[model samples]
Target: MLYDIDKERSALVFIEFQNEWLSDEGILQRRVIKDLDAFRDAVRTGARIIESARSNGWTVVHAGLDLRDDPDYLLFNGGRDVLGLRGAIPRAGTWRDKGVERPAPFAPLRGEFVVAGRSGASVLKNSTLDPFLRNRRIDTLFLMGFATHVCVESSLREAHDMGYNAYLVEDACAAFERAQHEHVRKHVVHHFGAETNGAELIARMEG
Candidate 1:
């Protein structure tokens, strides 16, 4: 079913669109991203969604992961290493020693919110995103970005628990493999929120 999205109380949240995930030479890209072409296509779709949101007066939030000062590398600890790669992944510099810059298409525009201090998968855990949305009176979220089964799914579950109306932009997200992406869309997304693509979402925003 299509949702009646309130432009004033809605936000388009982009998660983990940094160089470590989306760029050609991205550290994580080399480690996990299996289909580069498909991943790039999703990134382009996400960019289009952001443009539509901006034109329609919806809030745009960029949730980036910065692990530079994380003493514990929190993501790998506390049973969070679901991937089981643990020490072999994220490397030493990953998002730690390098800059957390996004690719050109995903860069934040003026008036858009860029959430910081997010070292984990879920954007709301250690970031100001929750408070920022609450302060602005926003309750609906359209989430898109890298690794559909990881960060995007994590945020969706948390958003549902927090009572926010969350929608997953299916085509605007990618995982290490196509099957992984399909798994969340088929079995997981509906449990937390509905699944919509960039085109349908843009049409709703424009309408």
Candidate 2:
């Protein structure tokens, strides 16, 4: 079913598009992403979505995880390391690390909101994103980006709990393995929100 989206009440959120995850020299990319070409393809699709959003006057947000100042692990002391590196992932100085930068296609524009201070999987955690959305009265969110099963999933769950209508752009997201992405789409996404590809989402926005 095609839902009528109010562009004024919707926001397109890009999560974890940092260099560390997408670029060749990125620590997470080198360590986790096996199919670089496939991941890049997803990012390209994301770029097209962003362009559509911009042209349609939809709100744009870029959420990034920057741990440059968490030397004491105060913000990341969960001890449930999923990366299997024993809490070594998202290394200190990641904020200043070259990997923290967004890829050229995903970079935020002059007026676009860039949310930071995210030290965890969920973009809404410890970040002003929730309040930012609330302030703008944005009720619908279009989310896409790296690690579909991780950060994107986390945010989808949280957004549901927060009463926002969340839509996951499946083709605009990627994970270390194709199976991981499929698992989220098949099992996780429907429970929290609906799934739409970049093309469908853009079409909805334009329509």
Candidate 3:
């Protein structure tokens, strides 16, 4: 069933659309470049959805990854391997060899809020996002961004548990491998929230 999301009470969250993940020489390029065409298509879809969501008065939130502290858990633990096959999440700009310092196509614009402190996979943890949403009376969430099985999945799971009506914009997300992306969408994410696409979602927003 298609969830009837009220724009006044829903928020669209874009996770980790940073240079380290989506730029030309991004850290994941070595692993995901094989599906670069699919990834780029997803980005285009995401950008369109973002524009429509904003124009229609939906809350737009960019949940960015903050690796500024270079946390030890991400380095020594298995976080590095899971985040990037090359090992470890790169900080913005300093890792020039890894990628250029820039935001991806669907980057946040004026009046859109960029929620930071996402050292972990879930954007709500160690961050002000949850309260921010609650304060705005947002009861539903629409999600998309890099590595569908990682941050996107983690945040969606948390949002569902937090009692927010969560939906994953399937065509607006990307992963290192097509198989990984398909597996998570089929087996994992469906367990938490429903799957949606840009067109259907945009139609709902329009209606």
Cα RMSD to native, each candidate? 3.0, 2.7, 3.8
Give me the displacement of residue 71 in model 3, in angstroms. 9.1
lDDT of 3 at 163: 88
Ranking by TM-score: 2, 1, 3
- Provide the clashing-pair count of each candidate structure: 0, 0, 0
Question: Of the candidates numbered 1 and 2, which has the greater TM-score value?
Answer: 2
lDDT of 2 by residue, 58-174 (tens): 899999876656544555453245353225653523444676788677788988999966656789977889889999989999889978988899999999999999999999999
lDDT of the candidates, in the order given: 0.83, 0.82, 0.75
Residue 53 shift from truth in candidate 2, angstroms: 1.5
Best by lDDT: 1
Q: Estimate each model's TM-score.
A: 0.88, 0.89, 0.83
- Ordered by lDDT, highest first, the candidates read 1, 2, 3
Please give, for residues 106-125, the per-residue lDDT of candidate 3 as tens digits. Answer: 56778887885554678887
Error of model 1, residue 199, in angstroms: 0.3
- Write the number of the candidate with greater TM-score, choosing between 2 and 3: 2
Residue 137 deviation, candidate 3, in Å?
1.1
